[model samples]
Target: MDLSAINPVLLLASLLVAATPLLLAAIGETIVERAGVLNLGVEGMMITGAICGFAICVNTGSPVTGLVAAAIGGAALSLVFAFLTQVALANQVASGLALTLFGLGLSALLGQNYQGIKPPSFPRFDIPLLADIPVLGPILFRQDPVVYLALALTLATWAFLKFTRAGLILRAVGENHDAAHALGYKVIRIRTLAILFGGALAGMGGAYISLIRVPQWTEGMTAGIGWIALALVVFGAWKPLRVALGAFLFGGIEVVQLNLQAAGVAIPVEILAMSPYLITILVLVIMSADRSGAPASLGRSFHASH
Candidate 1:
């Protein structure tokens, strides 16, 4: 293996790019779970967003439009789950699973013609002065706008959940929906909104994959990224910064593995390819060992009875 072939600076930048999708999805899922709703259809929503974004970009030749379309598509799909779980009071787990199935079939059908097609590229924002700095420039100052947006969202969500009144209400609802209901907060309305937000963010992440990461439309292109994002939410214990850290960690591993393979490293290609998933499982196991970081009411349905 040629050690010099792997540039540390480039490796870090690649990791950030790779982690963007997971960060976006995980942050969105974090908010949803915090609102006391568990939507397992993130994978479905993400792929649907991917196909929609790719298709729109191919048709319109605008990556921005494609991203917007992807968000709408993801939110639209989540509406199905929201309707079943929020309005119809259906089981959240089953409804989310169904949404995933629907999204998979829907994306496959929609993307049939789009297979192998490339989408417009997302624009990169290179910060002045900072981007020119040696070694650190690319790592810190050069990135797609979406990456910065994800970072801003992390801070915003953290502040919102920690300092804002609405955040308090949302957390209260998640912690005890019955008590929130007693206080006249509409639990369904809040949860529905959170679900929509989650779907949109996941969709945006999917669009990022099509527009910047993969740059092409393929069936099931998301390739379990949604599941990984879900696991990240847990691994981070529903915290935004920790979720981002987890994403970076996983992304770094993936990028390093790929680089090693490309550099003619002697490791098995299959093993390297599987490193991301393996790491995700390992992280989950270690986090589970602690058992104190998880939201107390995670995955439990909230019902209000008169």
Candidate 2:
């Protein structure tokens, strides 16, 4: 392998690009899980958002509108789950799975006319003084708005979960729903809001993919990134900064795999493509083995009577 063929700066930049979607989705899922709602439909929601964003961007010739539409689409899908879990008090896990299936079917139906179309490009923002620097300039300073937004969301999520009163109540609800309910907090309402927020962020991540990363429409375009994001929340022990770190790690692996293939490395393309998912399973196993930091009520349903 000609290691010199890989530019460290370019590799880092690619990692950032690949990591953004995962960061957004995982952070949002972290919030959802923290509020005692487990949504496994993230993959479906993301792909639906991807197609929705791509279609809207192509039709309107505007990436911004596409992203907004993606957020709306994702949130709308999540509302279904909220209705089932909150109003009907259905099983959270089952409802999430159904959401994924429904989103996939709906996105495919809506995207039939959008096949092979390219969406408008998202504009990149270059930091003033920093963007003018030599080799580091393009790598660090130039990126689409979502890249910066993902990082900002990480910090904001950390602060929200750690400092804000609403955040504290959300955490309390996740930790012990019975206690939070006794305290007069609307458990269902809080969880519903959290689920919607998660969906919107996940949708934005999907939009980033369609509008910027791949810049095209395809069925199941998100592949398994949503599942990876779910695993990342677990890998990070539901912490924002750690989840971001996990996203970067997976993103780096993906970038390296692609770059290696492009450079004519002897590795099989299938193996390289599978590396990201393999790593996700390994990380999940490691996290489960430790089992020290997982949210107390993850995947557990809460009822007022229980």
Each model's lDDT comes to 0.89, 0.88
lDDT of 2 by residue, 3-94 (tens): 78899988988889999999999999999999878899998889888887888888899888888899888888889888888788888889
Clash list (residue pairs), candidate 2? none
- Per-residue lDDT tens digits for candidate 1, residues 1-306, read 897988899999989999999998999999999998889999999999998888998999988889899999999999998889877878888988898899999999998898776676778999889999998899978998888888888889889988999999988888888888999999889988999999999999998898899788888889999999999998998888899899999889889998988988888999889988988888888888775665556666666764
- Residue 87, candidate 1: Cα error in Å is 1.9
Candidate 1 achieves a global lDDT of 0.89
Give the count of colliding residue pairs in each prediction. Answer: 0, 0
Candidate 1: segments with Cα more than 4 A from true spot: none
